[model samples]
Target: MSDKTESVSTLENAMQLMIQTFHKYSGDEGDKYTLSRAELKVMLTTELGNYLGNAQDKNAVDKVMADLDANGDGEVDFTEFIILVGALTVACNDFFLEYNEKGEKKK
Candidate 1:
């Protein structure tokens, strides 16, 4: 298989693993495996620790939550959570790939 294909497969596997793990912990109620935009934002912010500081502006997070919550529900379901997680995974993977490429170039 081509390098690009291999990369895609790897990402797919990683996403599946994440979803499985989430489901294992979250249970099957109301799509608990998926995370809403608000949930994801909160997670990321918490992970960032002191980097984000005390950013009170919830505009971005609100917008994402609103967009992802397609059913007009107050909370996110499993499908929406999966979509958001996929987007985040792609972004993070791309960022790391770029960083790795740059490092390789520097060597």
Candidate 2:
């Protein structure tokens, strides 16, 4: 492992992963810093299939693009992409917490 990677914390690694993943998709076409509709669709299906089912459906992808385009710019920038990831993480954390609490029978 590189010295830099070896010394990085888990949260830092996660942050880096997010940045890399966004750039990976964002560079596929057009602007290198934002995700066009096609790029967003590919990223969603490839990277988030488990979290977001039926990504192949155009309507689903369209809905996601609409929701994430906070600036109405028709493309998802890194900031918007990060917001999506953060929201999904929060949702997953909430789901897991609820699941654990239910299993523990804590009313």
lDDT of each: 0.63, 0.94
Model 1, 44-82: lDDT tens digits are 465433543442358756766687788886566667767
Model 2 stretches astray by more than 4 angstroms: none
Clashes of each: 1, 0
* Cα error of candidate 2 at position 13, Å: 0.3
Q: Top model by TM-score, which number?
A: 2
What are the candidates' C-alpha RMSDs?
Answer: 7.9, 1.9
lDDT of 2 at 96: 100
Q: Clashing pairs in model 1? A: 35-81
Give candidate 2's error at residue 63 in angstroms.
0.6
